[model samples]
Target: MNRKHFLSSFIAAATVLPTFKTLANTVESESSSFKIPPYLKQGDTIGITSPAGYITLEQIQPAVLQMQSWGFAIKIGDTIGKRDFTYGGTDEERLTDFQKMLDDPNIKAIMCARGGYGFVRIIDRLDFSTFQKNPKWIIGFSDITVLHCHLAKNYGIASIHSKMCNSFPDDWSKAELVQIETILSIKNALIGERMGYTAPAHPNNRQGKADGILVGGNLSIIETLAGSDSDLTTKNKILFIEDTGEYLYSVDRMLWNLKRSGKLKNLKGLIIGGFKVKPDDAGEEFGKTIYDIVSEKVKEYNYPVAFDFPVGHQRNNFALKCGANHTLTVSETGSVLQSF
Candidate 1:
């Protein structure tokens, strides 16, 4: 070959090789196995931090006492009693407290004290380098869905979606059976028990079976994070969503957003949890039920759809291990979700 021709080919290969290498790295990262943080054992410390809403120390005592009874020590973050309006603390304060817990080697798991708003304000600023290396359980639902989705997208790490400190009953003896069962579900998940839950069949449910990673929380929060760094990748996953106090029209809009974003495509299954819709005003009624809205959006898909699968803001809300592989079975009689 001529010297000029050889040189031109070499330059072209050098440029193309780097691009191919980069694409390969991206694919490898996306297909990597999810990392499950070490489960808790008796006497392990569980740090409690308020990364979202404001909660006084007194408000968390119920949780603290309950966890203590379960044989786990508690490390209360400074933001527990600190408040800045609706937030647990200023953005800086909340971020620092959460970061400390993430980096602490002694803390086996970090349980969010409560969920309201403000996680997104600090999510971008908090560093995960140390936490990524020493992965630990991050527990909460509601607004904490932001963290669950963020960790899944960026690090492929597992976290718990369940009731937080704010949900603990002040008196266990007086607590309802459902509340006690839901709370115990967290302990079972933390201690590495294979968790399974069953929900009664709804007439709207589509019968089928699937096995995939579990991913989802509040529908509104999931929609809010769409297109961001924390947006969920729902393809080939079992997604369960629940929301509280949204109007039927608003729920329809969010479902449309999910459909338009291609979030509802592909295989696996869907679980629709509790949706506490707000009543419409006298003159402005949206004439569609939650079932109708979801069915319309997902009618084209063949994957199974389970309605009222008991994970949400309601009393039946049980602990779910997000980013973990799960088997979903939906039949005419009922639905079963089993974590592996």
Candidate 2:
């Protein structure tokens, strides 16, 4: 072959090779490391426990009856009525109850009774070896984000970040009942389509579409887990965060923790959920709003960013499957979240 022909061919191959490599890496990033735990069926037993604060059986009786009405049996944990100050039980007792539920083969899922501030205390002491071998859904939000992150980061098992036993209503509304049933039922829970949110457009919202595993929960819990064994790896993954009642300065501080620690450096997308922040005091001023704090920190990323996602401590809180691969589409019109 002529020298000119050889040089031109070599340049073409060099340019083509990087494009192929980039495509391959993209495919690999989107591949699943997540396990979808077996969903519940009729007559399946759901073990309910208070892994955080104290709650009387009277408070949860409505939910228990509701579950039975839906053809599921409720297994109440010992911690349900026990009180040791603010928590249902001591750390040891709570951990034991949780471990028992985790190892119980008949318990198809474990639903948290409520969320307070005790999960981070016992999270490290609990064993998941047995649960890993026979995986089932672990459900809750708020403080339960600890368990969700632990399971996702260490075991790669998907969990429900939704309303807990305390949130279940006795007089169920049609829409609320449907949401609860959809996440608990076996077939549909694993493969059903997610109801998307139509968020009000914000100037800070970034426009684009992305696909990756969804990993995040309460912003405070996530911040606490940072740099730990169970901390999340946000690279090439979509993150959704929410928190409530925190001071504005603390919220800004947590956002900086995520940014400076390199957790927000790479991502497929970001979803900002309901932040029911506390109002500033009479004389104090935090200066920036929640949107201002977040947008400034994430200004460098070009990935899709959706604000006011309908998940968090609110009446409209929607269920999300942590560790599941999802397609996140954000536009000026709104956003859609779907599992693949």
Best by lDDT: 1
Per-prediction TM-score to the true structure, in the order listed: 0.91, 0.85
What are the clash counts of all predictions, listed in order?
A: 0, 0
- With a 3 Å backbone cut-off (N, CA, C), the pairs that clash in candidate 2 are none
What is the C-alpha lDDT profile of model 1 across 179-205, one tens digit per residue? 888898888888887778888878999
Q: Give Cα-based local distance difference scores for all models.
A: 0.85, 0.77
Q: Write the per-residue lDDT of candidate 2 for residues 1-340, one digit (tens) a residue.
A: 1111111001111000111111111222234467667656678899999999999999999778877876888899999998889998998889999999999999998989999989989988887878877888888899999988877667667788888877776666654643454334322342233423445667778899998888899999999988776687778889999999999999999999999998788888999988998999878988999899999999987899988876788765667778777788877766777765
Model 2 lDDT-worst window of ten: 7-16
For this target, which candidate reaches the highest TM-score against the unseen true structure?
A: 1
